[model samples]
Structure formats: structure tokens, C-alpha cells
Target chain A: MRNLADEIERFILRKLAGETNDITILQRNELADELSCAPSQISYVLSTRFTAERGFIVQSRRGSGGFVRIVRVPVQKIVYNKPDNIMDYCSPEDFENIIIKLNSERMITAREAGLIKYFLDVIDDYVNPVEKMRIFRSLLITLENNS
Target chain B: MRNLADEIERFILRKLAGETNDITILQRNELADELSCAPSQISYVLSTRFTAERGFIVQSRRGSGGFVRIVRVPVQKIVYNKPDNIMDYCSPEDFENIIIKLNSERMITAREAGLIKYFLDVIDDYVNPVEKMRIFRSLLITLENNS
Candidate 1:
């Protein structure tokens, strides 16, 4: 049996996949009741799985009108038919698409994909993955704050 | 005389080197008993040595059918060598030399080279360095495991 965390993560991702770009607001108590899990369990799933590093932004308002809002950030997509063509003349869009495909295909490990996403978001150079992730993260922060 | 932790660490590294994907899973208590050390010693070695920063991920499950899995994250390698002839393909030995040349030129980082070595062991493909490394790492863990 899948853990509650994984189940909740899949539920949120399934919902996010159906929509293009929008914030999904859900009441914690209602969500918890539906999942038959504690409110803290929902919080744990959100914090760990739906992190900004994974191309998601989550915000919450606590109180009687308490609700968690999740936004799926738009990311670029790349397509290649053959493995030999994977790295040829990659544009920013191409890189993002490659990452999206890799993640969707479950080709790269989650941690490895996270590292690559970080590079795409931060690094400017067409170089190493570690540096790439760092640069991508920096760029993302700059873009997010400015826009 | 090697400490129990050192012995166990060496044993794990040897196993990793012999394998293509270089990931090893074992039971903590079983390994500890075999090494004549406390289970905490295994944890100590894992914490000190097999860290994400050190290119290893340690995951464990507690209780029935529990096991500790150690996965080594291969580093990425950048290669700049290109063969002249279109028809004549490079052998594994030729590819190995290309890696050495890149390493000597300081074109590829040590971590990148390590990842390349891991990739070479896993993927059997003939292509340019950038594409070869990219494709290999991109699909290393996913392809066979899925089926």
C-alpha cells in the first residue's frame, strides 16, 4: 500500500495536471477528512512533495477560512525522438522540455531531476548539472521577485 | 586492523565498483552482525561517508521486510574529444581515452567524470561525448526498472 504522503502527493499532482495555470485552494479540515488523515499529514505532504524546487508554489491562509493554495508554474518542454539527439543545440525551452519529459517518463531519479531543475532555473552556462542547478535557482529567484 | 566501520565501508564500495548502476541494498542489523559491530556503527559510517554531498543517498524502511538501500549518485562528466572518421566508431577503450583526455584538459570536473564512468558501465552506445553522457544518465535508472 502506498503511504498517505505519496497518496496525497499523487492526488494534488493529478489535480494540477488537469489545469493549465491556476491556484488550487483547499480547506485543510475538509481535505484531511476526505483523505482520512490528520491535518498535519496534509501539511507534511505539501511541504515535502510540492516544493517550489519541483516547479510548484504553495501558500496557505490559516484560521476559520484556512485554505492551502497551490500554483503550478509554467515550464518549457523539449522533444527528441532519439537518445543521440538529446543534447544538440539546447535552447532554454529545449532544456525545460527535456527536464519535463525526463520527469514525466520517470527516466531520471527524483533527486537527479531536482538537481537538473535547479540548474535550469539558475545557471546561465551550457555546462555541468551542479552548476546548472545553482544558476537556475538563482535565475528563478530573481525572476520570481521581479515579476 | 581496520575498524568495523572501515571494513563495512570498504565492502560496500567494492560492491558499488563492481556493479553498473552502483547501488547496493542491505539490512542494517544483518550487516552489523556480519561485521561484528553494533548496528549504530553502520549508521555512523553511512552518515559520515555516504551522504548526498558525497554522492550517496541512504534510504531505509523499519519493521517487517525492512532494508537499507544505498544509492550512489554518479557525477556528470564533460567530454570535448571528437573523432574524425564518420564510419569508424570508437570502442570502449577509445571512449575511455577520450575521458582521460578531457580529464587532463580540465574540461570535465571530477564529479562529472565519475558520473560518466557510472554511465559507461550502464549504457552501451556509440555517440559524441555530450550526447552519450546525457542519454546514459538520463535513462540509467528508469528504463530497465520500469519493465
Candidate 2:
């Protein structure tokens, strides 16, 4: 990572993490001055790090008085209702249902959902349903763990 | 991979590889007829494997006489020509350059690049530079190997 870009991202992340509402608005010039980088650099950081697919909504307007607003959205709703070995017992339909729920909740983007749905469809065609369930379950568990 | 899907992918790959130009056009119905599979199955393979991120450009038309077109794009023009063990010898700037190129080439979605770039930033913050290079090199090498 470029040090400046990373610094800008972390700086924004820290600001967002500290906000209870999960929203932050800041000036490009002020942040650039603080970070000792050009304002353009801050814009690049915001555009890349705070994207819609990454669960962030960014609103910005041009002009000196304008500010950049970023809203952090949850990537997933983590609820462990099942036992520890969830993957061992879940069905493919269960996987599909949970993914649909997550998508509905805006945890993952529609593009990702499409990609994953196609993957599942292909896996279903080749693998046994039971084995496919295991794969999907493991993937969900991994995402949860990572989250 | 599903046996039929794999076969179809190989068929397309062979067609592309054999092309004097880096483009191929074929009707989905014709492919399905040859493979003895549903036309939708051909779509699944095309959408997944021939994605822009995977260095492909796909164009399609619908209705009767519609055709699916595939274009093979170079991925590695994004970066290369470093030493045999460049990751062991390069700086974070090198890593950033590679990723930026990949993003410009649409080899990875911006969200993925942001995730990676942010992770690298945190790693740079806490980890020694040498260790960071090793990680960066390893990621690039893995991608190359997989490609």
C-alpha cells in the first residue's frame, strides 16, 4: 500500500469507528493538511476505501465549503443461533436463504450475490447436495469468522 | 468443476488460444447443441470464468441468432520485469504499484483492492518492512501461479 493512502484510510477508519452513528463528514483540505498530502490524495482514498460495495456510502460535493460524507454499513449480520458445527448439519437451501437474507440486509452487494449464486448453482450440478451444503456452510462460517 | 462446464470452458479457451486475434464469437445455442447441455449452463460458465477481472471481455445479444463474444485480455501488463526475487528486495511502493495497475486493468474489483491495500497499510504500520515484502511477494506469486 502507498503509505499516504493507507494513512488516509486508517485515519478515516478510526474516525468512523469512533462514531456511534457510523457516519462521518470531514473536509478534504483540512485532512490533507493534517496528513501533509494533497487534497487529491484524500479524494482518491475516499473514492477507493469508502465504496458502496465495501459497505460504505460516500456523498461528496465540490467547492471549498463542501465536505465528504461517509457512512459505514454493516457487511453481515452475525448471529450464531446454531451449534458450533453449523456447516456439518446445514442444507444447501439454508445456505441460499441466509445469503438472500444477507443480501436483503445490504451485507453483501448484488454483484457478489450473483457471483456466489452462480457458484452455488454450478457446485450443485457437480457435487452431491450434502457435500455442497458442507462447502457453502464452511464459506459462511469463514465469512463470519473473518467479519 | 462440473465435467460438462469444464469441458465447455476448455473448448472456449482453446478457441481463444488458437485465435490469431484475441477474440472469439460463437452462438450460445450452437455451443449448447455441441455440448448437449442447456444454453443457461453455457451462460453460467461464461459469466463466471470470462469476467473482466479475469482478463476477459464478454459481449452478448439475446433473441434468435444472438451471439456471445469473448475477448482475451492481457492481465500481466499491469506489472512485471522485476528481479527473480523482487518481493524479497522491493519496497511497499512496489507492492502498491502492482495493485494499482491491477485495479486499472480491472483484474480485481476496487473493493478487493481497497481491502488489500488497507490490510497492507496496517501491516506496514506494525510489521517490519522485510516481512511486508515477503507477504506482498507471496501474494503476487500466488496470483501468477493460479493464473
Candidate 3:
């Protein structure tokens, strides 16, 4: 039997899959009621599985008309033209995260993502902070141009 | 007034420009005689101006029918799938040469090549030998995939 977290994640993914856009909105209490779990359980699943590193952005609204919004960030949307934004993504971890996110979103194939990650892993130690930023920028630009 | 070397270079370039292919074959003596220069001058221009690093491969066949063949290497031709070949092109100089050659060939725009070179230049000092190899392989694969 699958755990509650897995069930909730699958449920949310199914909702997103059925939608025309890469986004889905839900009422926390209603989702909890339908899943027969606590609202906190839904929050836990959202916070853990649907993260920015995993190519998802979850926005939780709290009020009388409260709802949760989940948006899947496109690979093209992450490309930054500004130098400061480019500098922000200068680490190997950041790059690997982007690759993983791209793979998960089906923007890039698993084989290509795996190969890119393999190279990223090997060169992490030698690539300095500045080089990492430049590489990340170049990669994003390449991807943007190709896309 | 243009020097003999400049004249010879331009003459050869114009000949190449007129041709349908990126390659041109010339009889050294005939070319020298036409340009009012010595055969050695043609040899000098071929050796110095048209080199592999400068994107031209000059093949000189000596005999009764001696001919100098200049072939412009396309950007797609430089992509290597073999591990050994990838390893051979691990140096910063090699990467820069590729960028220059690609730019000269109009395979990649000057701005794109410049951006790539700018990033490549800054990262050279920090990238280790193994890392350089990985980076080169990744870059080539990216270009190949995009192309």
C-alpha cells in the first residue's frame, strides 16, 4: 500500500495532468476532506514534492477564500538575461537542480539530462564560482536559443 | 598599398568566395605567377594565414602536378563522439580556436560567439584539466544536439 504522502502527491499530479495548463488550484480543506487526510498532510506533500528545485512553485493563500496554487515553471522561463540573475545561479547544485527540473518537466529528455548531469558532476570541483555562473548562463542561452 | 602576403591572402579568399564550395585548389606556381609573386610567397601565405586553427586545412601535394588544397572546416565537422577525440580537445586554446573558426565561418553569429568566448575566457583559469575535458565535451554535445 502506498503511503499518505505518495497518495497525496499522485493525486495532485493527476490533477495537474488533467488540466490544460501546467497549473492547478485547490482548496486545502476540500482536498484534505476528499483525501481523508488532515490539511497539514496536504501542506506536507506540497512543501516536500512540489518544490522550486523540482520545477514546481506552490503558493498557499490563507483567508475566508483560501486556496493553494501549483505552477510548473517552464525551462524557458528560468533563463535570465540580467547579469545579477545569472550570478544568482552559480553553484553546481543549482545547475543540477535545473537539469532535474527540466527532465521532470519533459523539457529535456532523460538521456540528455543524464549526460549533462554527468558532465556537471565531473567538473564541479574544478569550476570556480564565476565559471559556474558563466557556464550556467551559456547553457541557459543555448537552451533558450534551441527551444 | 597592400603587401604581397595580404594580396595573396585576399586573392585566395576572393577565389574561395567565388566558389560554391568552401574548398579551393590552386597550383602554387600559377597562383604566384598570376599575383606577380614567387612560389615561395604562395607557400608562405598558405602556411601562415591558412592554418587549422584559423579554420583552413591546407594540403600541399608536391609532384609534377603539385596543388595546394584549402578546405574550410564547418562547425558541425568539429563535433567528436569518441572519447579520445574529446579528450584531445580539452585545452582552453582549442575551445577558443573553435569559437573563432565558427565565427569566421558564419556558423555561429559574432555576438553569440563573443558571449561564449567571454564566458570561456573567464573560466579557463579555474577549470582543471579533467574539468576542461568534461566542459568541452558537454559544450560540443550541446552544440551538436542544437544543430
Best by DockQ: 1
Off by over 4 Å in 2: A1-75, A78-147, B1-32, B35-49, B56-87, B141-147
> Which residue ranges in model 3 land beyond 4 Å of their true spot?
A81-114, A117-147, B1-147
Q: What is the lDDT of residue B117 in candidate 1?
A: 50
Q: Write one digit per residue (lDDT tens) for candidate 3, span A1-147.
A: 336787889899999889888889999999999989899989988988987655678987899999999987655574453243645445566677777766676655554565455545544667766766666656655543432
For model 3, residues B1-147, the per-residue Cα lDDT tens digits are 869999999999998888776878889999889989889999899899987667776777675456888877755445552465444435667777777776555555554465455545545677667766566667656654654
Q: What local lDDT score does residue A19 receive in model 1, on the 0 to 100 scale?
A: 70
Stretches of model 1 off by over 4 angstroms after superposition: A1-7, A60-66, A75-147, B1-37, B44-69, B72-147
| Top candidate (TM-score) | 1
Candidate 1 lDDT over residue span A23-110, tens digit each = 6777788988999999898998898887755557789898888789898653322133535244435556756766667567543435
Candidate 3: docking tier = incorrect
TM-score of chain B of 2: 0.56
Clash tally, candidates in order:
15, 0, 0
Can you tell me the CAPRI class of model 2? incorrect
Interface RMSD, one decimal, each candidate: 14.2, 16.8, 19.8
TM-score leaderboard ranking = 1, 3, 2
